[model samples]
Every structure is written in structure tokens, then in C-alpha cells.
Target: MANPGYCVKNNIYETWKNWEAVNLEGMKEIGYALSGCNQRFLNFVVFEGEKVSVNNFYFIAHPYNLELPVLCRVFRIQPYNPEMELGRTGPLAGKKRRKADYGKKLEYIIGFAEILGYYDKGGKWRQMEVAPRPWDSVYEPTEDSLRQFLLCQQFAQNALVVEIGKVRGTSIPVYLDLNAIARTHTFVAGMTRSGKSSFIINLVRASSNLKPRPRFVIFDRRGEYGALMKYGAEVIPYTEFMPAITNPDVIVGKLELKRTEKEVVLSAVRMLIEEGESINREALYKKAEKVAETKASDKTRTKTLENIKWALDNKGAFIDREKKPLDIISQIRKTPITVVDYSVDTDIEAQQRTATHIINHIKDYAMAQRSKGDFACIIAVEEAQYLAPEKGAEVKESSAQGEAKAAFIEAISQAGGYNVGLIVMTQRPAYVAKSVISQCNSVVCFRLKSGNDQEAIMNYTEYGSERLAEYLPGLADHEAMLWGMAIPTPFPLIAEMDVKEYPQKAAAFAKQAWERMEEKVEG
Candidate 1:
């Protein structure tokens, strides 16, 4: 139940023209305001059964600088009469005696229905505080919410807040509207041990259940996403893609004086190895010229050569001998779920290269499907830090994981309106390239530490630094602040994380165990 009333503004001297017309949405605001009042005002004066026709459009100016600008010139106002005194209260704790100052006229500007945004009165007409609603990828979304997400596109609303896991008492779920993910590129970032991983798991699961399910693929470096196996996602381990003599399509290549592309491919067959080498573009054109002078290689030959030389044979795998779509569509029609699992123990070069191969393959797949007709897809990078490495490290400057992540994001960001979506999740946010964040339209922010992580989040997100400063110290475990165009609001909002289902993550209290160790040491 909600309280309801008409909007009345003090600015009006004669004409109610500036006064917005009343509608259901405007009524909702009035209801909220009146419901927030004490129950004792249940029998106030005015508006019970008045037969007055209400207007529904109004102009909004900055609540602060009256002349600056209007938040929105005009929007429909939803109005409904919640009797005269809109309210409901459980038990009364205390109450303030009424004063003559608050007269009986229940008229005031209900709200800027389109700006359900957090607006501050007196701040600016266009700047009144509206509610915050963020996008929530973790939500499986009821039929009701989906319709709301689509039809409510232009509604002035805030980011949604979703609380995960619940106790009978004390633990209220945190919720954030993450509607931005659907419209633009998005990001998920946090520090190690924060709830970033758990939150990501839930997000993937929810995305899997969309109306037209999204084809989801994940880069599971530590095999953390093994849990997703049950969700029907296909896992492509390094072993499966490694070409061998047993596979008729594969052949060994002889090493040349200087590394030839063939030798590099064979060496990388076991573990896709990548180390960037400065090469001139003219050389590639010249090499193509030499190849063109001869007959164009057929598909089998091209694919085999690529597999033997490079870890990635994307298009070659799908094109036929004459450079046409293959009669057999195994590459495109197999499984919808793809998980490229790497090991935590693997060397940096190997893991980075594997991630690159998978990303390149996905990029190609999305492009191919679009040129033809195919299912739309979403590629999720779980614990992306392993693949999206930090600035060049001596261990593997060749990986240039940072550069790889940027490339991957750029490719997918361009696909959103086309036929693809990208979900990038990471525990060590700093490891993810700054450029990648701008490519995502949605985000699921879990608990994060370090100003660098917080600052990076602020740059491409709607969450403010002031809130970042306040929330950083109090990120209840895996919970995050989600914000982005993929979500609903233009503001940052909270999302309670759901990690209780992961038994592997559970453990005894650490502080108690540490205390026992200290006692033993003293003894």
C-alpha cells in the first residue's frame, strides 16, 4: 500500500501552468511522502473525493540555481488520491504535537515523475534528489520486473538495490538497480577476498535465464567457475583444443633458422604461448602478396597451418576450402556455454595466451553469426585479473594481458547493439585495464579496498567518490556498489552479495584460529 496526494509548489503565485498534471507516478511520490508521515495524520483535510480533473505535465528547473537549467522541460505526472491523509504506521514509538504552521492544504509539487533520480530541493529545480536505481545482473528477473525494465525506460528512477541472502533478523538484503548492463558496456571490480567472485557467480546465473538466453562464455583461470558446469556452460580446457597426431587434422612443423609462423604454432599447440614482437605491417601485406601470387589456400589447409603455427585458428575453423561457410557448422552450433579453464599454477604466458585465443574465437563467432543469422551471445570474464594482467611484469611482458583485455572489451563493446554482450569480473581491479571499463554498460561492484580500485570504479561509473569514501570502509564482505547504463539509474547503488551457497568458501572464524596459534606459540 502507498500514500498518495497532489503536488503543490510554493513558486506558484497565480497560474498553476507551471504546476504539473497529476498521474499515477506523481501519486506514487505523494504516497511515499505521506506514508513517511506519522499515522496520526490519517484524517487530515482535503482531496478525498474531489471531482477535479488533474493535469499531468510539468517543467522542472534546477532546485538550486533557478536560472541554470531544467532537469527536464516536461514529463507526465502520475497521480492518485490516497484518501486525504496518505499513511500507515505499525506501533507508535513517539509523536510530535501538530502546529498551526503546517496548515490543512495538502497541495505541493508531487515530483518530477521522469526524474525519480535523487534530487535535492533548493539545490536546483532540475537538481532535486530522486531515488537511486542501479542495474542488477544477478537478478533472474520476474516477468514483472522484465516488463518494467523495458517499458519503464524513460521513467525517472534510481538504481535498484538488491539484498542477497537473508537472516530472520538483522540481515537485510542490499539491492542496487543495474539496468545499465543492457544498454551499455559495464564492469565488475573489487579486491581479493572481497565478495567479487561470489557476486559474479550469481550475475552469470541470472543472465543465463534472460528471455532470450544469452550465450555465456567465461575465462575461468583457476577453474573457479567449475560450479557453472551444472548450468550447462561448456568448458574448453587447454587439453581439448591442443592439436595432436591423434587428431587427423593436426601435423607437426619443422623449426626454421629464425622462428617461422609454422614453428611457433606447433610449439604453441601444447600451451598457447604469446609474446608480442614488433612487426612491420608492410611485411604482412608483402607476405599476403606472395601468398596471393599462388592459389588461395583451402579451409582445411589454412586451419591446419594455423593450428600448427598459432594457438588461434578462428575463421579458418569455419570457412571451407573455397572461403565459404562450412557445410558442417560444429564450430557455431555445438554448445552455447563455453568455459576456458586455466590453472592458477600455470605460467603467466600460457594462461594469457589461452585467454587471448578464447577471446579472439568469441569475437570471430559473434561477427560470423551477425553476417549470417545466429543466437546472440555474452562472454563473461570471471576473475578477469588473471587474464587482464597489470602493467608489464618482468615475468611476462610478452603476455601484455592489459593490452589483450582492452582489445577484447573493445570488440564486445561494439557488439552490444549488434549481437553480443561482455561481462568482465575481477578481484584485483587494478589488474584490469582502464580502457576496458569504458567498454562495459553494466556493473556489479562487490566490496573493494584501495583508493586506486575505488578511483577506477568512479571514472567509468555513476557512483561518486564521496560515497566511495564512505562505503569503502564498510563493504560487508562480498557486497558491491553497482552502476552503469546497463542498469536503471544514473546513480551508484548497493547490492548485497550472495555467497552463502558456495560451500568451498566457508571456513571457521580466522581470528579465533589465529588466537589459538598465538597461545600455542606462547606455550
Candidate 2:
């Protein structure tokens, strides 16, 4: 009745029509692919009435030539006109009429885009080997298509996604893969008040919604993360959250004891632990006195004891007997988020020692959990520069700080396998330890004003080229460039989501204090 070849042709047409209905609908034609296009990059000339922009996603519509449209991101744009010369003082420009029209109608844009591959029938992004044909129509993807293009569909399907913010210039939400982030640490850097802390807070809040939620241990140097309590976090003051004293070297480092003094202190701590006594300031001092009496001359013993007493008086707040000791590890396991607030403590060395103790304990816990095939937790370090300064960067860094830095470095390199993630944030990227920063697999960079800091970030991320670096200083507050394993794209400019203001107790204003003093004098 009907020719078999004709029937096959009709079936092919019907199939293409169905695919076009789903894939081509709502795509706006903006340009045509130019001749210089390649597998990795696309060159296009924008239509006279249409527009294109940097960082926007577009697709080449060539259904017959390719099974699916190829997605690309425009990264560069320039104005061109064949009739007009751009050079002002050249002989060719001078010969042309001075009043010649350079009107909008005569100008068009030349767009350069990076080929970001195409989705296969299984909804996976696969590398595209074939380039688009010259003169093929280029269209701006619809919002839904753009979302499909930018997200890792497999990760999204598992609900292992957290919304960090919206894509810049669009309302489309951008999500990070939680599993990727947990497997590979993230580094966040920016100048103060550049929304670095706010971004971290948002990430923590979003992560709380996932199934089989991972715990958060936040070392909040400035006490800012207390607001997380509203989301079911336990904010423990630094003085009360005492980790078990498993190592005497921690105390020796904190005190910065001399050679003889350090040995005596270690002996004392060992004796206290072996006897099952609480490792408080009083017990430690008594044990040290006994060790000194047995080993040192009267003059040397006197000096060592006096030095130990002085150091303890100033930096041994954690070992104070009056404060009730809470087991930090137990809290970490039970709580969804545990924040150690250090706003009340001004001694930096003491803070370093405390952080070292807690980190060591967490590391051990994570390793144990890893053996059981359980994911442990994420540790967020705020003001990381103070605790993990670059080697020899701070002349005043004590042994305590050095130990803290070492703990962070080890955690960054080894903890991912244990399902422990580190979120290392700093206002001074140049001051943070290079080894620690280099280990982070994802980067969320905010506004940075210093050249050294920008250079440091450039070395860490794959997409941090000179052109991208130019955008750093001008980034608006809460705007950041996100790249690496956590996100699907190589890099994307995102407007960080707004977070609720946290509670911060304001200091007494100078004027208010002075007026109060004057009133008291009048009284």
C-alpha cells in the first residue's frame, strides 16, 4: 500500500517534531554560530535586534546535525562594524568622513563562549566532540533549560543539594552538591564585611535540611555564629567547653615552656592522667611542683614553678577548676551544630590551644566513624588566619598557634576520607597557611582588595585566571565567584542569599559612657 522508504521518512519527521516540541520551545534566537567555532569554544555573531551577555547560557539549535543542542556560556563580548574604523588617528580613519554614522543599527556583538557540553538521553552532561555548523541558529536557553544545564542532575535527583544563592542577573537558584562538598573541603576568602561569614552561615543553615544530617562544629572566633542557635545549634562559651586532656604536649605548647620547663610540665601532666585525677589548673600546678622538687636544683625549680604559675594565670582559663567541664565530643555527636564562642576570651594563645585540643579529639572521632561507614561532621573555622597563619608569616605566633595550624593542615588533607569536611574562612588569604588553603577543592571568593590575597586565590582555583581576577575588587557585597567540585559549572557569579541578622551585643558607645559619667558627677 505505501512505500517502506517513505514510511521511514515520515517516522523520522514525527520523532524530530516531538523532540523539537520539548527541547526547542521557549528558546529565543539571538545569533548565529560563526565559522571559528571549535569543540571547546564557540564564536557567534549576535543578530541586529537580539542581545547577548557575558556569563549567560546559550545553545546552538541544530537538531538535524546533532542529537541535542550544545550548551555554551558566553565569556567575552565585543562590538563590531564592517563599515566603520575604530582607530581614531589612522590614515584609513582620517580618509573616512568625520560625520559618518556609527549608529546602533550598524553595530553588532561578537560573542565568545566556552562549550559546556550537552545533555544525553539519560540526562547526563557529556563532552561534545563535534562543533556547531557555521550559520546555525544560536538561542538563549529558557530558565528551565538553563537550570538543567547548570545543575548536576544526578546530584540534584538525590536531594543532596543546598541552595547557596541565585545566579547573577537572574532569579534562578544555584545549588551546591553537599556530597561533593563533604568529600572535598571548601575555602572561603574575602575582606571583612564582604559577606564571607554570611555565606557560610547560609550554607550551614541549608545543610541542616538534608536527610541523615551531618553535624557542624563551628569555631566562632568572634561569637557571630550564636545566631545559629535559632536553627537548633548549641552555642557553648569557650571557657566551659573543655575537651579531654589526652595530650600533655597541648598544654606545653600553650604555655610556651622552655626546654627544661616543658619536660617537667609533660611529666606532671602524665602523672596526673595516669592517676585518674581531673587535669585542672590546681592539680597540674601541684603535680609540676612535685616533679620540679625531684628533678631540679632549688634555684631552677623556683624559676620553673614561677614561670608555670605566671603562664597558667594568664592563659589557663580552660583548665580552671571553677568552670564546669562539658565533654565537647559528646556534644558534637548529639547536636546538629555546636558553636564554640570565643568572643569573651582575648588571649589568642589560649584560643589556639583550645582549638587544637578540640580538633584532635574530632579527628580521632571522625576516623573511628569512618571505619564504621558513617559520615561524621563538618568543622567551620571562622577567622582562620589567626589559628592557621602561613608558616613564618607571623613573627609573634606562639607554639600554640603552630600546633593549631598543624592540626588544620592534617584535617584538610586527611579528613575527607573520614567524611569530615573543613570550611576554612579568612579575611586575609595571604596570612592563611598555604598547605591548608591549597587542599580545599572548592572556592567561594568574595571581594578582595589586596593584590597579594588575589594572587594567593588565583593559585588555588582552576578558573582563577587574570581576567577573572579583574572582577574581584569590584564584586558587590554578598556577590561571589564559586568554582570547583561543589558546583557543576567551572565558575559562576552568584548573588549570595540574604540571611537573617544574628544577635550581637553592642558595646557601650563612647558618647553614651561619657554622658553617663557626667550625670554621675552632677548627682
By lDDT, the best candidate is 2
TM-score of 1: 0.50
Candidate 1 per-residue lDDT over residues 1-523, each given as its tens digit: 1111001111111122232311112221111222221211111111233221111112222333333222111112234332223352111111344332323233333322222221232321222442212210011222232222222223123222223433111243323223334335557777666766566566555444433344556666666666666766666665344221211123221112123344333343322213332222222223433443332345444544444333223322211122222211253256556666565455454455445555566566667777675645556677665555456522343334554566576665576664556677776666676666666666766667678777777775554434464455466676566555543334444545656334133244889889989999999
| Tens-place lDDT digits, model 2, residues 1-523 | 3332233334433443343312755688888888987777789888886878776778875444444777777778899765555663333654774544544357688998877666666554567777777988888888776655554333323325666778877776666766666678889899988888788787778667666576888888777786687878988887676544447886777667887788888999999889998788888999999999877788788988888898888977656545545777789778989988888868676677778778777787788877687557778889888878886675274557667888878878888877788888898899888888888888888889899999888876666666555567877888887877777554454555556553344456789989999999999
The candidate scoring highest on TM-score is 2
Where model 1 places Cα greater than 4 Å from the true spot, the runs are 1-126, 129-183, 207-210, 242-333, 371-373, 390-406, 462-464, 498-500, 503-523
* Residue clash pairs of candidate 2: none
Candidate 2, residue 291: lDDT: 96
How do the predictions measure up, each by TM-score?
0.50, 0.75
- CA lDDT, every model vs. true structure: 0.43, 0.74
| The 10-residue segment with the lowest total lDDT in model 2 | 3-12
lDDT of 2 at 180: 67
